[model samples]
Target: MNDARDVTILGEPERSDRPARPGREGKGEIHLVHMYPREMSIYGDLGNTRCLAARIRRHGYAPVVHQHHPGDELPEQVHLLVGGGGQDSGQVTVEEDLARVGDRLRSLADDGVAMLMICGMYQLLGQTFTTVGGRQLPGLGLFDVTTLGGEERMIGPIVLSTDFGDVVGYENHSGATTRGAGQAPFGTVRHGRGNDGSDGTEGAITGHAIGSYLHGPILPANPAVADALIGWAAEASTGREFEPEPLDDEVARQARTRQIARLLG
Candidate 1:
C-alpha cells in the first residue's frame, strides 16, 4: 500500500475486540477491496470503485474500501474485489502478485464474494493470455477462457445487451478471448468487437465474478450491473435475502441512452 496514494481507512471502529467473521463486520458493513488500484486502474477504471462504494452506502450499509496493492494479503472479510486494466508491464507485475494469492481469490469467489475484473485483469483471470510476440502469460484460471493477442486493437464505444439491461461502455483490447465449454458470457455484443471479433460475446461471468473488456469505468454507465454486484456481495456477507432500495438512476440512464444512440448512429 502506497501511503501517499492509499490511506489507512478510518471507518467506524469495530464494536467488539474479538475477531469478526469473514465477510461480516460491525453493523453489517461491506468490505470492498480495490485491488492494485495504483498499478492497474488505467482508463478511468477507478471510477468503478467509487460507483460501487456509493451504491453500497445508499443501501444503508457501511462500505469500507481498501486500496490494496500487489503482494498485499487478501482480506479475510472482503465482500467484493474490483481490479482494472494495465499495460504489459503492469500485467506482468499483477500476474506475479495474483499468482501468489490466486488460491485465496478463487476461494473467496467460491465463498460468494463478487468480483469485477476489467481488461488486463479480465485477461489474467483466464487460463492463458498470449501476447502479440507469442509470449504466453499464465493466468489464475478463475474462468474457463483463454486470450490471444490480435494484430489490431479494438478501441471504441460499445453497447451490449445483458439479462439485466442494455449496458453501454467502451472497449479497448487487442486480445481475442475464447470461452471453454460451460463458460457463460456476461452479455452478447450488440455494437462492438467483444471478447473476440467473431463471437458475439462481450464478457464472461462465472459464479459471482464478471470479467469484461468494457471500460467506460462500466459501473457508472450501468447501474444495474453495479447493483447486481452489490446484491451478490450483500447476500454472501449476510447469508440472507437482501433487496436493496432502488436509487434514482435517471442520470445514468440518460447517459447510457445518449451513449448508445451516438455510438449506434
Candidate 2:
C-alpha cells in the first residue's frame, strides 16, 4: 500500500496493492517482511517498506511485500525485514509475539539476512529493555546492547556519518541504549542524540542486521542506506553480486541537503 493508514490488523497476510511500474523484468523476486505493521508502526515507519518496494522495482526486481503481525507465522523465505517504532504499550503488546519468534529472527540475522529495526523494535532487538516502571522486556540479543526507559524524550532531526555517507533521519525516543564493548555501531552521531544522549554512537549493526532509532521513516531520504540493504538481501538470496541500476533521486537529495543545512547550520 502507498499509505501506512492502509495497513490493517487482519488474520492473514496482506500484500502491497501497488502495481509494479515498468522496469527490466526477470531479475528475481525479493521477499520483504514487515514486522508488526499494525501495532508497531505508529511513526509513519511503514513508508520504509513502500520505499523499498518502489526501489526494488526500479532495480528490476519484483518486490513481494509481506505484512507480519502478532500471532502470525513469518514468511518462510524472507530476504529482507523491516520494522518500525511504537509506544511502550505497543511494545508490551508485541513483546510476547516477538519473543516467540525471537530465535527465528536471531537465526535470520546470523544467516546474513538484511534487516532494519527502528526505535522500539530496535530496543527490543537488543539484550533487554527496562521500562521506567522497572518492567524489563526481554530482547532477542541480536545486538549487544541494552536499553532503559528514561524521563526525557530525545526528539529531533539527526545526522549520522556512516559508510553509506551521511545518513539523515529523525529520532524520537527516550530509551537510553548502551552498546556493549566491542560491538560495532551503525554510525556516529554528527548532530543529534544517538543510542544514549552521551554516546557518540547512533545504532548497532550485527552482520547485515541494523537496529537504530532514526525515523524520518528513514529510508526515503537515505537512498544509500536503502540500497545497501537491498544489495545485501539481493546478494544473499542469489549468491551473486547484485548491482542495482541507478534511479533519479534528485528530490530525495534536495530534501536531505535542506534538512542537513537546517539542522547543522
Candidate 3:
C-alpha cells in the first residue's frame, strides 16, 4: 500500500454497466467520481471504491469510477460520486480544483444523487471548517456543517448505529464538525465524541448523501454500507432492486473475516 494510494483489492472494477432501460446492457452505468489527488490513500480510502465496485458486481451490476484529476473532464453520467479522506495539507493544496466542482457536486446531492464522503472529503463538502489559523474558509456548502479547530484526532476502532445495523469504522480527523439547525447528523458517535470535553463534534448527512469520519476503507469492512449505496443507485437510476449478498465461499468468508477483524481490532 503506497502512502499515496492504499487499495486492498477485495475485487476489481467491472467493465459492464447497468441498463438504461430495465435490462438493457450498458443502458445505465453507475459512475463514481473521486475528487482530490489519490486521496493520499489514507487508511484504505481506495478500498471504499474498490469495495463498492466489487459489491455491485456481486449483486449483478457494473460500476465505473472516474478518478478525476484537475482539468480532467467530468463523466457525462454519474449515479453515485464518492470522495475520501486525505491530509489537511493535501486537500488545501487542491482547494481551487475542488471548488471548481462545487456547483456540479451541489447539484448532484441536491437532486438526490447518492454519495458517500469520509473525513477530509466530508470537510470539503461543508459550508466551512475552522483551521488552526483561527480563520474560517469557505467550503462547498453541500452540507450544513463546519469543521472546527482541534489538536487531537480520533483514531482506532469506532462504533456507530445506522439503519443498517451496528456499523464499525475508524476515525482520524482533527477538524471537528458542527451541523446547522435542521441539518441531519450523518452518523452518531458510539465511543469518543471529541478530543476533549469542549466542542463535541459528530457526523452529518442529508438525504442519500452521507459524510462520515469512519475509515478502515469503510465499504470493505461493512458490505452492507457498500450494498446500501449500490442499491440506492440502482433503484434511483435504473429502477432495478439490488440486494448485497454476504460472502458465502469459505475462502471469501475467511478473507472477509480476517479483514474486518483487523479493522475492529
Pick the lDDT winner.
2
Candidate 2 off by > 4 Å = 1-23
Q: Give lDDT per model, in order.
A: 0.82, 0.87, 0.66
Query: Where's the lowest-lDDT run of ten residues in candidate 2?
Result: 1-10
TM-score-based ranking, best first? 2, 1, 3
Residue pairs with backbone atoms closer than 3 Å in model 1 (clashes) = none
Model 2, 120-238: lDDT tens digits are 99999999999888899999999999999999999998999998898999999999999999789999999999999897999999999989999989999999999999999888777
RMSD after CA superposition, every candidate = 6.4, 3.6, 6.5
Residue pairs with backbone overlap in model 3: 18-28, 19-27, 19-28, 20-27, 20-28, 186-203, 186-204, 186-205
Candidate 3 wrong stretches, greater than 4 Å: 1-28, 37-40, 194-201, 243-265
Q: Give me the runs in candidate 1 sitting further than 4 Å from their true place.
A: 1-27
lDDT of 3 by residue, 203-234 (tens): 67788888887787777667666777787887
Total colliding residue pairs, candidate 1: 0
Q: Positional deviation of 218 in candidate 1, in angstroms?
A: 0.3
Order the candidate numbers by lDDT, best to worst: 2, 1, 3
List model 1 lDDT by residue over 16-127, tens digit each.
Answer: 2122234332336778998888778888998898787767766655677887777678776899999999887788777788889988888887876899999999999999
- Which stretch of 10 consecutive residues in model 1 shows the poorest summed lDDT? 1-10
Relative to the unseen true structure, what is the C-alpha lDDT of residue 196 in candidate 1, on a scale of 0 to 100? 90
